[model samples]
Target: MSVLSDLLDADWARLCLLSGGGLRPRLWRHVLSPRFAPVLLIRTAQCLHAANWPRLAKLPALVNFVLFGIEVPPRMHIGPGLVLMHTQGTVLGAATIGANVTLYHQVTLGAKDIDFTYTMSMRPIVEDGVVIGSGAKVLGGVTLGQGCVVGANSVVLNDVPVNYVAVGIPAKNLPPEAERSHEPTIDQSITM
Candidate 1:
């Protein structure tokens, strides 16, 4: 699909996520929301970079950084339907992030070590329908499985299985029955 199509889908998905599946938000309402503005800029940067306009891509990225304190590289691969509950101080350096991922403020997903050069092996791979809570740090080349949840302020360095919950420092998977206890209150409507 074209970048514009993907961006439009993303915007609609974000609106649905934010509005609790009630009335569809108007274009101006979605565009004017503070929370959605940074996401739009990031998406624009990603599209520009993918189109081989790297120099122009940096403009939106720079604006996002200056306005929201969020640093998202134009090269980062992110699927549509990403909802950042709060944008400030959130740094995303993932190799590939799948669809319907929700991230709260102060969430950091990046290299575990000092690797200035970004590579698949040095970054986190987040699967679809994942929710990362505020102040969480998911480091290294770990894979966060589909539908899994990461608790706030946790440090994850290993892989998490699908539908599981990871909490605490050096996060370990919670028992299947205990998943709901750790998951945040956000209503995740995305499936698959």
Candidate 2:
């Protein structure tokens, strides 16, 4: 199988392990499966810890917790390549997330109200390759355009334009020249 296929298979296997009913064998399978390495195991454990340890504690939930690093309620639909950098404190509401999205720590993607009375009440729809920074909150039926960068600690209450950078309490788009000057460089030694 190709790498993507392998990842998809692993993701499916993980989902089955997490939400499925069987207990002892599932746990054993998760531990003994050669498909899961040490890093994945540790990350899975952390996701379980964050998820308050669901009943049956199936492998799928563990996989979702570890790989995606977002606390996606089982009902939520998420596409593949959901990269979670610093997965801790990320909460995904009941919404469909697209593929290849990168989320940092402390991001929230939830609805404003549980009651369906308001027509405007809805969750955020994250598009592909959209990078959300730490502590950013995208609330209420907003569409994050593709390849947009949400700056750290920004509160995004409006739809962001594609390929733009948003930063502030109520996020505003940065000018093209200013955005160009704000390229972030990473040190390989640091953890994502």
Candidate 3:
């Protein structure tokens, strides 16, 4: 599919429409109506909150709550078409996230503190089309490049390159070119 089509997919667009309350709605409308440049920021925050984090599989029901008081730390930078599937209790620290990223529930993109008063010098940078799975904790100054997929419940502390899939506690990359053949495909072969 085309980039624009993917970006403006019906599911994502619908999520954007239902993000915030009075001010949030106004702001979101203003951003989306004109196709604003910084619309990605709103999308990122809204998706992260709406994804029903901390709850592995109950996202769609949570989207109806009035998300007026949620805190999306302003230190983070988010991109467009970001999908937060089951995004509850997700905390994003001072980091940069690229376009079309997907984050699952209970994901914490936080920083390690060097001292009681000082946060670590580095933070995470998530590139385009990256998928961060449920209950994953991506800490420190790791840079995940384009198309990287992080598996569920993984804890990431190292850098990952494009098209690689990382899993486990330290989040190591799968074997080279493993993602191409091992991509997750949910089958409905046992249809009702």
Candidate 4:
């Protein structure tokens, strides 16, 4: 899907809230809104980068840095439907991020330290539906598995198993539950 469509699809919950649970929102109106401005800048940068205009891509990213204090480098590969909640002082220098990822303000997804020579390989890969809490720092080349929930201010340096909740200064996964009630199940043979 196009970035706009993917973004809107991912941000359905926010759209519903913005429209007071009305029908789906119009593209230009919502994406351009201040609340979604950070995401917009990221998208713009990505588009510019994809279009082989790295120099031009820096413009929106620069604006994003100045206006939002958010630093999501154009090199970062992010899936659609990002949710940047309370997204001030957020830094996304990760290698890859999956769909429907939600990030709170002050979250850092980057190298372990000030590695000037570090490449994208040094950054973390956050998978789909992961919720990173405020002030969380997920560093290193670890893969944060899909559907994981990271607690606030946690520092993660290792791979977190899928669907587990990791918390603390150096994050550690909690034991898995017997069954997850929050997640939906699917069966192709079943009918609604």
TM-score of each predicted structure versus truth: 0.86, 0.58, 0.57, 0.82
Misplaced by over 4 Å in model 4 are: 1-9, 12-23, 179-192
lDDT of 3 by residue, 75-154 (tens): 34566666565544666563688877777767877675542332535778889888899888888888888998989999
Clashing pairs in 3: 51-86, 51-87, 52-86, 52-87, 52-88, 53-86, 53-87, 53-88, 54-106
Candidate 4, 70: how far from true, in Å? Answer: 0.5
Q: List candidate 1 segments past 4 Å from native.
A: 21-26, 178-192
lDDT for 124 in candidate 1 is: 97
Please give, for residues 1-192, the per-residue lDDT of candidate 1 as tens digits. Answer: 377566656766675767688547447567666778888888889989989999999999999999999999999988888888898999999999998889999999999888787888999999999999999999999999999999999999999999889999989888567545654444653431
RMSD of 2: 11.5
lDDT of 4 by residue, 1-192 (tens): 286456656665554554476656556667566657777788878888887888998999999999889987776788876878766898898889998788889999889868666487788999998989999999999888899999999999899999988899788887457654555457633644
Q: What order do candidates take by TM-score, descending? A: 1, 4, 2, 3
Q: What's the C-alpha lDDT at position 176 in model 2? A: 42
Give stretches of model 2 more than 4 Å off: 1-70, 115-121, 175-192
Q: The CA-based lDDT of model 1 is what?
A: 0.86
- Against the reference, the lDDT scores of all candidates come to 0.86, 0.63, 0.60, 0.81
Residue 102 in candidate 3 has what lDDT?
A: 71
lDDT of 2 by residue, 1-192 (tens): 244344444443544444464333234455444333322433343344446664433465556566645565544445555545565667767366766666778888877667344233388888876889999988888888888888999988888878888899999987545557654557633644
Error of 1 at 50 (Å): 0.7
Steric overlap count per candidate: 0, 10, 9, 0
